[model samples]
Target: MTQTPDETASDAGSQLLDAALMHVPFDGWSDTAFRAAIEDTGIAPAVARGLFPRGAIDLAAAFHRRGDDAMVTALQQHDLSTMRFRDQVTLAVRLRLEAVEDKEAVRRGATLFALPMHAAEGARLVWGTADRIWTALGDTSRDINWYTKRATLSGVYSSTVLYWLGDDSLEHQATWAFLDRRIGDVMQIEKTKAQLRKAPGLSSVLKRADSLLSRVKAPKSKHSNLPGGWTVPR
Candidate 1:
């Protein structure tokens, strides 16, 4: 039986995700490899390739071009040399000691990072896009789950790149190791949550109270005071 467009897109997305993780740099941001990856799932290679580098600035623009799928394609088209990866990675890490400051490249890198594992390849291409945004902003550290998210995704991207560099395994043992660490962290979090759920009501309440107190003592919002003393516009 023939597959629906959605099915074809999903399969294509999975392949792209795998390819991204493998760090197989394409000849161009919108390279033939990316197109082939998606086309292999039955989508036309030309259609798949057209989804990338659309240059849309907003979600609406992205949606008009098929949303996340289009964005991922654009990401694949990202120009690392123009972004100055060689300079930024070195300067930020060496001189400024602030590697996270290169938010743009980091964001682009993140997008590439999540491409392979996107839930529906073309469906939520935004996942990869958002991953890049977060990484670029260096705000991943600001959230409690940032470490988990960044480490896992980074592992996937980095490990895959490592594999592509010289992987002999079916899917690359190094990549598997990276994924294993990420999965382990998630499992640990789940186990902790489960244990907390089984705790006595009073204990749970105390934990909740403590959490609330911590928030209360945390730093104030950066945008606490805006024009007219309103934090949010009406």
Candidate 2:
């Protein structure tokens, strides 16, 4: 039977994700061993290296320092010829940071990190694996709601990491909480903009304002008084 387009895409995506995760450092994996494993999985060594840019030590150090520059430098060391899906994601976050100020970079990084949660099926697997204890005790629900919950949680997790990237504060928890609040505010702003787009009078008000502003000043309609040196326009 012919596979559907979505099924084909998902299968390819899963393959890429498998290749990407072959060397997660937290699993006592060395970069050399991970590279070998990725090679064994049929992914080219160049591709694997590009996807997992930082060596275990560098990755750990960058995480400890919460340094965006370190992360970007690591990512930039790789060639794009063998770029994987996760590599694209990491690049996205890094580029976003380079494009903005530190504070805005945190926000951009958080949102950019969340993009993979929407695009990559592997994100659900990663979140589920990490939060298995919570999933085991939580009430079972429709797949949509389950996915929604997972994405929301993943978004929060991403935001926390982003906040840590630029956090100079003594307490990391406060930075994490600040990011959460900022995410909420960003969501509210998006919702408000969507609602305003749908509202009836919004376009009319904008158009009227534009029209009023568009008229010429007519040279200020110079006036001068009759005997008191003031005269009105003729």
Candidate 3:
């Protein structure tokens, strides 16, 4: 069976990521870890280099993407349709968080992204994770509302991850409490937005933003429906 380009990349990423993970705690997410991973793969150095030209950053992004992909699969076991939207969101986040057993590795990744020069990369990573979680939860939004929802969720997930990193309580009880508070904040914001939408003269601005997205980006894939389950006008 011939693998498509995406399949092949996914395969390489998985292999390299598994190998690199063993070295992360000691070597950090630097070339040292990639070299160790490459050596473990027994692949030519050039091939491993090609797989991740930017080295650790590429690997880090791939690592998160791998987790995000797995999160989608893990969510399948739960009947999200039976839950309310808030419950679905909570479960989806928990499922994603549960996928990582290497708490130290997550800590390292967080440190890596926190570098001053990597600010944009860190933002992208947060946005990507939030986008994946929302998509995995059946978000079908479009337009500016799409961006706003993901932006809101990025705040939630990123803050939760930060909180989780330092959490040592049994079962991460503190982190979950933090998550619930953040989710509550989101619900409150939604309620406020609902009231704002009721005020006159804002409809035209939102409609234009939605129209702009369709013109500039259109639909790209199953996970490409912008992001977030904003209640857009049909």
Task: Give each model a TM-score.
Answer: 0.28, 0.29, 0.82
**Tens digit per residue, CA lDDT, model 1, 6-101:** 887656555554443232243222344454445445656555554444311121123222322333344444454565433322222122112122
By TM-score, the better pick of 1 and 2 is: 2
Query: How much is the lDDT of residue 229 in candidate 3?
Result: 31
> What lDDT is reached at residue 216 by model 3?
39
Q: Which residue pairs clash in candidate 2?
A: 224-230, 224-231, 225-230, 225-231
lDDT of 3 by residue, 60-171 (tens): 8788777787888999888866788887887778777888868888888888889998768888877888888887777776555567778898888988988988999999
Model 1's C-alpha root-mean-square deviation from the true structure amounts to 16.7
For model 2, residues 196-229, the per-residue Cα lDDT tens digits are: 7667989677566545444422122125332112
Among these predictions, the greatest lDDT belongs to 3
C-alpha positional error of residue 36 in candidate 1 after TM-score superposition, expressed in Å:
16
User: Which model is ahead, 2 or 3, in terms of TM-score?
Assistant: 3
TM-score of 2: 0.29
The per-prediction CA RMSD against the true structure, in angstroms, equals 16.7, 21.6, 4.9
In model 2, state the lDDT of residue 98: 38
Clashes of each: 8, 4, 0
Scored by CA lDDT, what does every candidate get? Answer: 0.40, 0.44, 0.80
Candidate 1 is scored at a TM of 0.28
